[model samples]
Target: MIWKLSLTGMKTRLRDYMILFSGLAIAAAIFYMFESLATNKEFLEHSNTVSVVGIVFHLGTVLLGIITFVYILYANSFLMTLRQKTYAMLMMLGARTSKIAQMIFIETFVAGIAATVVGMVVGVGLTALVNRLLVNQMGIVVSHYTPFNTAALLVTLIFFIAVFLIASMINASSIVKKSILQLLNEQKTPTRFKRNPFLLFIETIIGLLSLAIGYYFLAEIVKFQIMGLAIALVTIILGSYLIFHSVVIFVISLLKKSNAVVFKKLNNFTLSQLSFRVRDFTQILSMVSILFALALGALTVGLGFRNQIMTFTNTAATYDIVLNNAQKIDQQKIDTLDPTLNVTYDQKYDDTTIYYIKEQFDQHPFEQKDQSVFLSGEVNDKTLKYDAAKMEQDEQAQKALQDLELPEQKEKQIKLISQADFDTLGLDESQLQVINVTDFTTILPQIKTLIEENEKNNPSLGGAEGQNSFSQKYYVYNLYNTFFSGFEFMGFFLGIAFLTMLASCLMFKILSSANSDAIRYEMLRKIGTRQSLLKRAIFKEIGILFLLPGILGSIHVLFGLQMFKNFLSQPYHNIWIPFTIFIVLYALYYFATIWIYTSIVLPKEKRN
Candidate 1:
């Protein structure tokens, strides 16, 4: 008889059970996808550029675990509420408390086991699909990647089982404590506003201060290092919570006091619902804000790094194939490039007497070495060294250098010409004109190779020592690859983390408060309040809830990105790409949340 009753209870509450199962399944799938990249030690070690990437993944797992744990607890609590009245009836019929407790535990465990089995199957399939997409997007073959990680599956199952067992015990204990009368009368009570102006003021001030400190640390990330990152993170999280707790109330109060907008149209009803709803959800609101900031930051930085790579590649090279010793085969290879290719050619030389009279004067006050070979086929290692003692002792080098003191040796005169001496160099008229410094820097690699070939063929012209002299004349382009790599990697991870947290927090909050909302909607229907009005209220309420976090978080990201301007060559370039992507994702989640919330909260109305 007890088993029959338990099975009937499960059948009756199938909708609620389905919600619980679906939520867990989605969470598991996302977790598995993250783990596929994070847990593969060899893949992460090889592909990841950030030194602390493994640590970041560990932290991500911990955060996701906490969110999932909380979600499960909340879902179980709702299930307990649904069973409370039935349990009371059983107790009245002389069923033992211990028997009821045992039955409840069995039900909870059954639900958990069922959910886990389905979730794991879904997770494994999703992991395989996501891995394939990521591989294609990145254009890299990742070996040793396992979509079906036995360890991840085991860990997820164990962790979820423990959570369910703990929740079951709590539910069982609650059943033991509650009287039959209280259980029969159990229904959601309307939440009341408990305003304390002084507390609100204090919270607002503290929150502002925390936010300020977080911004300061973010701005000076280089100096304060990891300590700053930790502090900023903690402070920002705290501040966001306090802001939701205090600032949201303060805004609602201000809206209520306004005569023009508060009492106008549906604003009064909408604002009332927002105030009451937000009052019960201060922590969730704060969490949503943090996630929004993280998501936007990640997408922005990731796209920025990609843009930088393209820019660097474009700026470094002008021609597809630039060769001084171009053979017939080499020319054919160049011709086989993309049909849209463009090419240009310059003269070839075997020996060149390039003069650096101005550089000698700049280096020495007296005329000792009047000329230096700026380019040669065979670069001599010795010419690269600067002999300060020998340069200082020459009186003629001193006299030549007295009036015009140069900033650096590289900026001084360095000359290069074709090895074919002026006549047989085979130079085109346009190529004969000396290239501008700006343009020359872009083609420096081609120029260096050309010089090397010429000196190789004509060894009499500065060969070994001259090679070193040529090396000293040129500057190596510093693109700062290290810095961009770090930003790109961190950005991608941060984006994913933020979106996951945001969706979970908002989804949980909506679902948790849904039971109360159902009654409110029912009351509205019984009265003159139209079904349409109730829906509009729901839509407006959700809109405000989602909009506030996104707007404020975007503002924070804008100011935060300003701090990176000094470091990035084109910090603001293509910034819109990330923003657009964020908006599209955010909007989809918002619409999905509204649909889910309505399905859970709205009564079945007749279609006109």
Candidate 2:
């Protein structure tokens, strides 16, 4: 009997179940995609700048995991709400509470198992598609990495199943304890908004202060170290919550004070719905804002590094190939390439050197002094030394050349000059040769040959070296490929994770309080509200819900990028690329949310 009942419930609530299923599937797929990178120890090892790659992936995992957990819980709660009245009726019909609890458990477990199976399949397809895109963009053949990871699959399965079971148990217990009257009255009661003045005041002040502190710490990331990052994280989260809880309420209240405007043109209904929604959703709104900020920030940072790679490569040299410590065959190989290409040979010695200059009295007169300066204001006989030995031997003076690892007197003899001077020496610049523009389209095979030869001969200078050693030697590709690859991979994964969380949170809150909203919509329909107006109301409500978090998140990312200024050689370069990407993704989700919400809240219109 229970088996038939469960199947009927599943069929009847198929739409709601699909929402939960889709959310889980997206979460699983995104998680698998991320893990393919994070857990691939071999891939990370092969990367040139493996320094922060692990850290970035680790943080990405943590953020994604938190989002997944929150989304699953909310989704499971939606599932429970769909069955609440039925569960209540079962208890009222003399069915044992324990039996109903057992039924709820089986239903939830079944849903979880079904979602996981479907999600894993979707996840594999997404991973393949995204991985292919990245490989093509990067222009390097990455070994075919597996999309299906056992550990990741197990972890995702365990997490969702546990959450579903817990939610089902909570729902069952709540139903078991409630009086039949309360159970019947649940759908009719309206949830009231409670305002505590002192709490609001405290939260508002603290939130503003937290945001200020977070901004300060982020701006000075280099100076304060990891403590700054921690402080920024904590304060920003607190501030976001406070902003949603208090600042948003304050704004709405101010808007409500104008009686004429508040009630004008369906504004009253809009504001009332927004107020109720916001009051219940402050924390989730705060979290969503933070996630959006992080997703955008990751993309921005990746693009920034990519821009730096391009500019650094383009500006530093004028060649497709630069070989340092070359061999005899290497020269022949270079000569065989297109004759029009400019090949400049140069020698580079690995050494640590420094220099000190002696002052000439006539050229730099001692008496040309500015006595207004209290401390050593001018070049004077007493303060200025001409003796190189004296300058080098002085312990205080010698400290400046400590990086050179030479006797102070020996270090003083070295002077660095421009490449123009070295070229005049005419000795083959110790094995460093720059090959100027060969056709980019035709040069791939030749470049590949050069890379293989160089790796064979030197055994240390890996692959084809380009203009900037950093990009070619390190990133192993041109600027465009590197930047595009990183952006595509990171953006797609982060976008999926973020949108899933956003939709699930919005859906959860809307559906949880949906019984009340059903009445409100019904009342409006009876009172001659054009179905269109109610539809508009639904759109406006959901729009505000998505818009607030998005705006705040964009602001956070804009300022957050400032923190990277000190570290990146060209921080702001190509920033618009990521911003444009984010804008498109955000706009799509916004419209989609409105459509989804409308379908859930409003009934279908009648045909003429």
Candidate 3:
């Protein structure tokens, strides 16, 4: 009988169940998607620039798991609220408390099972689609990436099922603990607002101070590094919450104090409604604000990393191609490149110094834009110890020598010697060839092949020991591409997931109480309140709810990006792209929330 009644309740409140199921299912899907990426050993190994990629993704998994757990718990609260009246009536009619507990467990578990099945299927498709899109958009070739993995599937199944079971058990226990009278009176009670000026003032002060500290730490992040990041996150989160709790209410109270503004048509009602909603949903607003900042900040920083790649490669070396230990076959490949200018110099290195053949340099006369090589002038004893600090005094020399592609050139000195002196060293001779082509990007594959061959004989030319070695130009470029592309993928993935979950959270919170709010809207309608005015009031109320968090979140992002200044060449480069995407997504959700909230709470016209 209880099972039949629970099923009947579900049928009657299909809209509420739909919202609950969809929210849970979306949460589950995102969890699965994240796990799939995190657990994909092949993908991580292939695409990673650094070794810590696995650890980073694992940490992301834990954070996302915590977030999903909280979301499920919050969404389940609405389920409990929807069933309170039904449970109360059952108990009043002599239904056993144990049977009521069974009903709650059955209902929650059934919904969870259904959402989990659908979520996994959706997760698979989403992962594949997103990975493909990111690969294409970033022009990165990531091999060994598979969206469907048995480990990810198993982990998602186990994690979500456990979460759901725990939630159901908690819900059943809590429902049984409530008295019949309390359950009956819960929805009928209104959330009251009481002003405490002293507390509000204190909260406002604390919030402002916390935000100031967070901004300062972010600005000086290069100095403080990770510790600064931790402090900034805590202070900023606290400030956001306090601002929503006290500063929002204080502003609304001030707006109410103005007689002229209050007397404006429907303005008073709008403010009253807005004030009530703000006071009620302060914590949700704060959470939404933080989520917004994170979503936008991740996307902006990710794209910023992408923009820095080419800029870094260009400035790191002057020539399009720097071929060290150049061979005859290498010259053959270079001749195919149709270079505008080619400079070849014989090089010999010993324990502490490199020798550049002066006769070869004199014949070629390496020049760039009417600037000759800095080592061209005569030196005492025909030798010059390479001093990077002094070399910077001549920009052309700094740029020209950087193209030599010698390992640890900055730390080593260079000597210019005649043929007789060069033979006296008895060191092995290698040729350094610097070539420039009309287009650099079009010849990456050719250049990459040369780099690979060079690295085979000379492993030191790679990114391993000499991280800043110019010989590792190709390696470093690919390293940055893969590293930043991972960040980009993670950013978009989490941004969309968090935005969806947060939207559902706010939506479920508001719509679950629509039945109680409906009575008020109906009473206003019967009192001859125009439908258009009511619509306008709904617009104003929800708009303010959306606007407050959005403004604060954007401000947070504006300051938060300062932390990435050292990591990215231009942290603010092309920042408007992410902001535009964020605004569009946020606006869409804002309108959708207003539409749905209006449909639930407002009284429709009695048309024929």
Candidate 4:
């Protein structure tokens, strides 16, 4: 009999179950993706920026895990609400509480396992898709990554199953303890704004200080590093809760005090409605806002890094393409590109350096360019002098060069020698193919391929000979861009996961209290409140609820993005693009929230 009841309940709330299932699956999939990169030292070993990337993915995993855990609690709480009244009815029908608790456990456990299986499948697919998109679509190569791992799968199942059991036990316990009368009255939440002003003031002060401290640490995150992040995390989260719970209530009360505004058309009703729910769901609102900031901020930083790639190339390379050991196929590919200025020459190199005579590059001097946020340089006729890559900066690098026992300075660089100097060296010349293009980005793919092939055929051109291939600036920049692309991918992927979970949390919270809202709306309607006014009121109330988080989140992100200024040349560049994306997403969710809320509250005669 319990089994039949559980099945019937599952069928009844299939839509809610679907949201929970998908949220769990995506969360697991994203976690799998991050762990694949973070734990795989062998894979991270390939990139120059491996350490930074590894830290990012590791932190990402922890963050996602925490948020997922919270979401599970909230989601399960919602599930319990769905069954509370039913459980009450069953108890009235002579069903034992313990037996009902067993039924609840089985129902939750079954649903969890089902979601886990489907989630694992989706996780695998997402992993493969993310890897492919990062490597292929971004014109980058992140080779030797495992998308589907047995350990990750096992971890996902054990973790989620444990979470489900705990939540189910809590849910069942909470229901069983409540008297039949309380269970029956679960939908009716009294709107009682009762609080001490002095206590509220003190809480707001503590909340502000906490937020201030968090921002301080985050601002100088480079100084504090991970420890700072931990501190900031604790403080900011606590502060956010207090701010929403205490600060927001005080501010809304001030608005309520204004008689002119309160007497305005439906303003009084909307604001009153908002205040009532705000007190009950303060933590939810705070968390929703924080998560929104994280989601929006992640995508913004990703787009910013992506945007910086093209800019990085603008200055990082003077000659768009540089090929050593010019093969016939390479020449054909370069010819297809139709470069604005192409130079094919020869140079001499031993173990430590590649050298070309000044006269060789004198005919068509390559443009020397420099770009930065504060300073910019124009293209000028400059002979090849410095190394294509940045000069080695540390004492250890110089010592390492000396230890290697290479030529004079032991600093591998492009050398400009006078003819007399070149004659003295007596080193054999290596064929060189170089090009200056008007537009490199358009044919970046062919250029990227050409550069990769050359690096593969001649490892000596890369560094101080015997080192990993670090080709010309253009190619290496693209490689760096690829690494950052992985960073971008991580951010974008995690953002989607957080957004999904947050939307689920907020929507469920709103809908779960819907039965209570129905009574209020019914009372209002009987008092001659038109459906249109009520709808506008509904829109106003929900809009404010949605907008509060958005505003708070915007504040978080505005300050949060400053942390990335060092990594990104212009962190705000094209920032509007991501904001637009976030707006669209938030708007869609907002309207959807209104629709769900309306359906539950209003009569069917005026749903449109």
My TM-score estimates for the predictions, one after another, are 0.63, 0.72, 0.81, 0.80
User: Worst 10-residue stretch by lDDT in candidate 4?
Assistant: 397-406
What is each predicted model's overall lDDT from 0 to 1? Answer: 0.61, 0.63, 0.73, 0.73
For candidate 1, write residues 1-608 as lDDT tens digits: 76777778888878667767666666666565555545656545553342234454455556566767766765677678778888999999999999899878887888887877787788788767755654543333677677888877877788778888998898889887889988877544445566888999999999999988988888777678799878888988888888888888888888888989776756787787676645557766776787788678867966676555434433332222222223312334333332243322222222332222223323422212222321221111222222334444554443333211211221333232323443444433211111112343455555455545644643433432432221222211212233344345446645754665576567656666677777777766677776677778888888888887887688668756755654455667878888898888888778888887888778455212
Per-residue lDDT of 68-97 in model 3, one digit per residue for the tens?
A: 787778778777887888999999999999
Angstrom error of the Cα, residue 442, model 2: value is 9.7
Prediction RMSDs, each to the true structure: 10.6, 9.1, 6.5, 5.7
CA lDDT of 211 in candidate 4?
87
| Candidate 4 steric clashes | 0
Tens digit per residue, CA lDDT, model 4, 1-608 = 78888888888888678767777878877887777656655456655554456677777778788878888887888888777888889899999999889888877887878877887787787877766765564453566667777777777778778888887898788888998888888666655675789989989999999989988888888889999989988988888889888877887788889998888878887777777756557878888888998999988987777776666565555567666667434466777888887876556787767676666555544334423321432222333332322123333323322322222324655556666888788777655566777776777777667766776776554541334233255555656576577678777877888888888887887777777778888888888887888899988888877888888888888878877766777777788888898889888888988887898899687444
Error at 563, model 2, angstroms: 4.5
Q: How far is candidate 1 from the true structure (C-alpha RMSD, Å)?
A: 10.6
Candidate order by TM-score, decreasing, is 3, 4, 2, 1
Candidate 4 ranges with C-alpha deviation above 4 Å? 12-15, 29-62, 92-94, 124-128, 138-155, 177-191, 310-319, 324-435, 448-468, 606-608
Which portions of model 3 miss their true places by more than 4 Å?
A: 1-3, 45-53, 133-146, 217-234, 311-320, 325-342, 348-355, 359-415, 419-430, 436-442, 449-470, 603-608
Error of 3 at 115 (Å): 2.7
